[model samples]
Target: MKDETKYSQVWNLDKLYPDGSASTQFLDHISHIESKVFSLEEGLNFFNTPKEINHSSKVADLIDNIGCIRINLSQANSYITCLLAQNPQDQNAPTLKGKTSSISARFDAGLKKLQKILVKTDHHLWEDMLDTADLNPYKFILNEWRKKADMHLTDDEESLVSDLMVDGYHAWGQFYHSLIGSIKVNIQVDGERNELSVPQAINLRSHPNEEVRKESYYALEEIWEEKKEQFAKILNHIAGFRLQVYKKRKLENILEEPLMENRINEETLSAMWKVVSKNKQPFIKYLNRKANMYGHTKMKSYNFWAPIKNTNQKIKYEEAVNFILEHFSQFGTELENFSRQVFNNEWIEAEDRPNKSMAAFCASFPISGESRIFMTYGNRITNVLTLAHELGHAFHNHAMKSINGINRQYPMCIAETASTFSEMIILDASMEKAESGEEKLFLLDEKLKRSVMNFMNIHSRFLFEERFYEERKAGIVSSSRLNEIMHEAINEGYVGSFDNPSIHSWAWTPHYYITKSPFYNFPYTFGYIFSLCIYAKAKEKGKEFEKDYLALLRDSGSMSTEDLVMKHLGEDITSEAFWEKGIELCVRDVEEFITLTS
Candidate 1:
């Protein structure tokens, strides 16, 4: 019963490909995308700077093909991604993934030409093409495309960079994928030893057994510690690639592309961090109290996810799903129904299996108007929250199902809006329904665990990446130096919370090696804090806010974070006060926890 692959519900990916990664249909799908990539590449040379977009339908046709190519490529890639995530050691999946990635690189080269033309297009003609070309729905993303043209090189140089990245920049990330997927964690529970996948090992972080939690943490640290040098090399090379590209683009700051990618400005980021820094003392206070509960002056880094004594901690899968859907129904019937349909239809892979991917996420398919969520559910309360969280992402995608292909893209910062908001709903509901002080404390601790993660833990990652990039410009950062930076960041964020922080954190964090998005740390904080503010608004407005929430999710595609806040909630995220308001919500819970403990 404990084996997740056997007892827990598994997602049916047959809708995606009947035979999974080995499906001939899947191969045919990839082939079609490859052909489309070639066709699109051939058309890239037929135009220069989008001539007469207002009069000629040629540019419009080109834009349409670009959209088609982009979506088709993504759909194929997403299918293979699903296959790999389930069993990272899948033999055929890697080859197929590489093929799709190669096709994607070629597709990106052609897309670069469109980006160049969009940059040089007349503003009036660009506006006319938005409507005349039937691309008005994508106005936000198209305008966004024009905004970043200052960073572009010549058309040929840009295309070449895209082509070269297939085997160079992205290849590093692919290598990391191969390395991490092969890792296995050995652990013993109740005199029985077992080998676990990285994700399964990670799930033990919140296990109720103290020794199991400690053993799992050390197992990960020991394994990743052995790979520190290799991980450091990957980190350095990944950073080097970005830095070289930045140098070639004539961009002065490393933060420029990350900030732009998240659709945020430095001021907004600065303001958010400022608010967190101001609020950290109380969070530290909570942490100190948590340490006292464990009879230690300082909580060890391995014990960060330690739980308190409680009667009800282990939540079964069936109970967890009912809890989430019930809580979601309180928010809106639509969210509840969507999640129910997804769960009933087997759209989530929650099997606790060996060689599974680490952590959880929802991947949406534009072609099918569906999303597949991946996770190894451990049946703890934390796992229930994860269930709610990923469904929120699926709901976000569902909310934007009617949106155009290009417009569906949003910055990752606001991408957490619905997910975090959904977590808040579940946390609040569980807190209110607690039957005893112990139950209340348990739920409160879970809520604050999220706070601890978003505030201290995520902050540490941000600091590490920021300092790592700064140091990387000078030379390749060493494994020892990487460890030092990681420790320093943790110490700075946690301050007096932990005497022994996890030093090998840089090695195990998949986000650090991810080539698609850098500085992925801050977005979690933004989403957490930003969603708190939205949670407040939802509670104040009650069920009516649900409509507004859906609207916000729908408009999330490519809207700047500040404008989204201003238009929906009328708050300026660039101001410290807005961030302060959000942080204050978490502070209230922390203060309550401290008082209850005292």
Candidate 2:
């Protein structure tokens, strides 16, 4: 008999739009966006003249008003993204998502016009404008505009780039996603043949059963191998479009744009990678320990994410929430209280269903000051951890609810700080209270897995992209070459720990295809170690650090990455020693795991 329990398995879309994509209210919102984009585009023409920056009072008001409108636009887009993630098969949702994409392009074109004016502003007047009531909150972004302004072409050319990007660059990313959604693999689970979405098969790579993991891995590779050429096209076209853009902008180094977007200098990035390179040995030791426990001299790539101790412990949904909240309360009531509200408010979609995305995300509605987390949950420990991670993002957004929308545009480097930090709070607390060696080892694997992922996995992604772009400069890279690059990246990244590597990972991963965030890689390591340093401080300072921590999250968008860290932690990001402190913390975890397992 089926259980009669009616769990809040799906999030409430009524608050966003009563009827999802078909909602009359949703159509009204889309129409409003179309109209607003037109009006904003026309009004942005006031800044066509370079001298307008010095004289126009309209610039400040326009900036504030446009920022306000962007919040509503984001709310609408968030709804569509949630809808699409829930049901990629929905024909109506795709059209609505495309409308949002078009609106986004027009919206970005208007911002470029505004950026051109800001670029041409006199330094003294720009400083004066930052002090104005209307634009004061947007100082950091305004300054960033002027600092990176030289890369821009003429205003019209810049606008054209944004417009063409709608169907040109971003469309490739959309294409990959659509393809992935339609893909399915046939496999046997529990003595029964089953059909699974690409995302579902990928998730099984973490399954505790070795046969299941191996079967899913081979099935995944076969499917991805079949479609390698099309995947290559997606990767090539996206990188090709970017390279051409950089060429037109006279950008010499491909990393220049990603570095600039991340609000970090080459030196800071180098320092982080330097520390990561030095710590690779420790991570490999942890990996070897994991392999030995599973009776393998060398682990396969599919087993990399498999939990140790042969455990497939299921953590119940409500139990996971209570477990997270119990640990979260140790830090402060506010975070705990906010998390509770999120749970009770049905702000999460955790239904375990086919055709749903495997990845988890926390999307904030800037206008409503709320956030919704999306994921495929199966009451597993991994699912609980993912819930905590997304909830951390939600809490971060909640912390900044009082700030203006424009001021909340933080870079990707600092974006994962809260989410990673939140995970640690639960992990550390759980480890401290574990009853058995196996239980502790299981938790140890969870912690060490993250360490290796950030230290090794993300580093490989960074290295792969760095090399890919460098080689791509010569010509379009063939599918075979992409595999070579991916194989090399994986081999070097894992330090030869795996016998059979997941080389086709290049096709299965979405981060490489994200057009907006070019280098969607290093920031994971940055946020990981950076938050380790923060977590260390919280340990030393106890509850005293919570207030400053929340304050830091609030100020994440309003300052340089270095300045933000210095203000809260008095650390210099450019220095190697600062990153070393955090990496050392990870090293110590590996050391403890070794001792415990021995």
Candidate 3:
């Protein structure tokens, strides 16, 4: 019998375009944006005179035109990216990407000129510009631009930096991406040799058999070891370039830019970490119990994701879809309807295939008011939770549909809130429905593993990145030194839970290679903890909280992280008390796992 539900399905990209081929509509839109960007650049000349610049009609029209261009560019860029992600081997993808990059560079040049004009304008006139009725929708974006303008050089210098970044700074990131994608490692499983990509090898850490997991770990280590020197050079040049840029801007702290990017302050970050650090003992205890179950003295990096016992329960894709919808409905009808729209529209690509990307992401198109989720589903419980996670992101986008353009983009810190909250919903529901102690234990184990990873593993990555930047300021850090720093960070994060930590950790994390966002690791922890707090509130308030939760998601793009939390949850993010409460919920889970195992 051929079961349709058993097979993996490719997503329908026709929603973005009639076909993968570039159509006249796409080309015309790109041309229109290019012309608009050029016109905006010419409009910058009007800013020379306060009278002309302060004319409310002139400023309002300019803002509206810029917003239009931004929306069109975003839609086009999203389409190109979706096409590329669907098929990395698409020959035309590169050409289209280069063209898009050129368009983006030109737009950024015009934006720089605009920023200079706004920065040079008198304070009252800039306020008047913002107060213009037609510019009301772009108030948040314009205000943000004014703040960012303080950190930038002159328009010409900024343009030069943007131009150089194409081949200079960002090329290092591109090199790392290409290298990792092409690299493969050979491993023997069940007396047969198999070659695996970087992601496939990494996935083996969760294999049921210890030998296979350990072998995969060593195989990955060997591959990364061989490439460590090249990786070191890439890291050095990327960091050096950032430091040079920061020096030009006279920004002393490396963390400053990332903090601003994440829309958070130092106090909030410190408070969150302090609570996380204090709560590490409970996680270490959970790890100890897990290691004992695995018949080991202490848990190693390879054993972190090791399954406690294999479950016979295999959830088909359809079953998983229904499962997520049922739980989402329990939260709200709106959420349930959103999930239905995603599944019915075939907006998800869950096929397990060769040469496809190994990670999952939810990309939302603001102009179209739609989202596409990408993941590889293999009928595991984890895959079900991943679907729920990505759908959470989709729901967030759906909620923000009514929000103005450019204001729909949220920071990474709050970005994970909906996704993690979705995981919590499914995790709790699954735990409640488990028919046996064994099933319950497996669920608890999975839950604990996730918490530990988010709280500890992610913390280690943050620590390593922080120290790397500090040391890199002196000179180029060697491959061995990178390993040493990674080991130290791991040890610190693990809190002695592991007798020997993974040194090759630095080599595999693609976060380090991402030139756009440095210190990208800490935001995961922030989102996890923040979501936990929100989840606790949802449980407490029950049905009444659903509206507020939606409101939180809708406003995520418009407010600061702290303000968002305060408005929705009535909590101060900068206080240790709030973070400690979230940690306590995690500790309760750990305590429950200990009791079950005992």
Best by the lDDT measure: 2
Q: List the residue pairs that clash in candidate 1.
A: none
Q: Which of the numbered candidates is closest to the native, going by highest TM-score?
A: 3
The list of candidate 2 runs beyond 4 A from truth reads 1-9, 48-56, 131-134, 181-183, 223-226, 353-356
Report residue 309 deviation for candidate 1 (angstroms): 2.4
Q: Per-residue lDDT tens digits of candidate 3, residues 510-573? A: 9988999989888998999899998888888776788999999988887788888898888999
lDDT order of candidates, best first? 2, 3, 1
Report the C-alpha lDDT of model 2 over 1-598, residue by residue, as the tens digit. 2212334757998887797778999899888878877878778765453343344466666766677768878788888888888887788988887788778777876776677767877777767767777566677887887766767888777767876787889899989999998998998887889999887788787787889988998998898889999999999999999999899999989989888888888999999999888779988888888788888887777788887876556667777888998989878788899999998889999877777865689998887789999997876766778888999999999998998767787889899999988988888877887778888888888899888889888988888899999999998999899999999998888788778786778898899999888899998899999989998998888777889999999999889898899899899999999999999998988999999989
The deviation in Å at residue 79 for candidate 2 is: 1.4
Candidate 1's residue-wise lDDT over 307-414, tens digit each?
Answer: 765555677788888888887887787888988888888889987777787758888887788899998887676677788889888999899888666667778888
TM-score of each: 0.90, 0.92, 0.95
User: What's the lDDT of the predicted structure labeled candidate 2?
Assistant: 0.84
lDDT pick, better of 1 and 3 = 3
Worst 10 residues of 3 by lDDT: 1-10
Clashes of each: 0, 0, 0
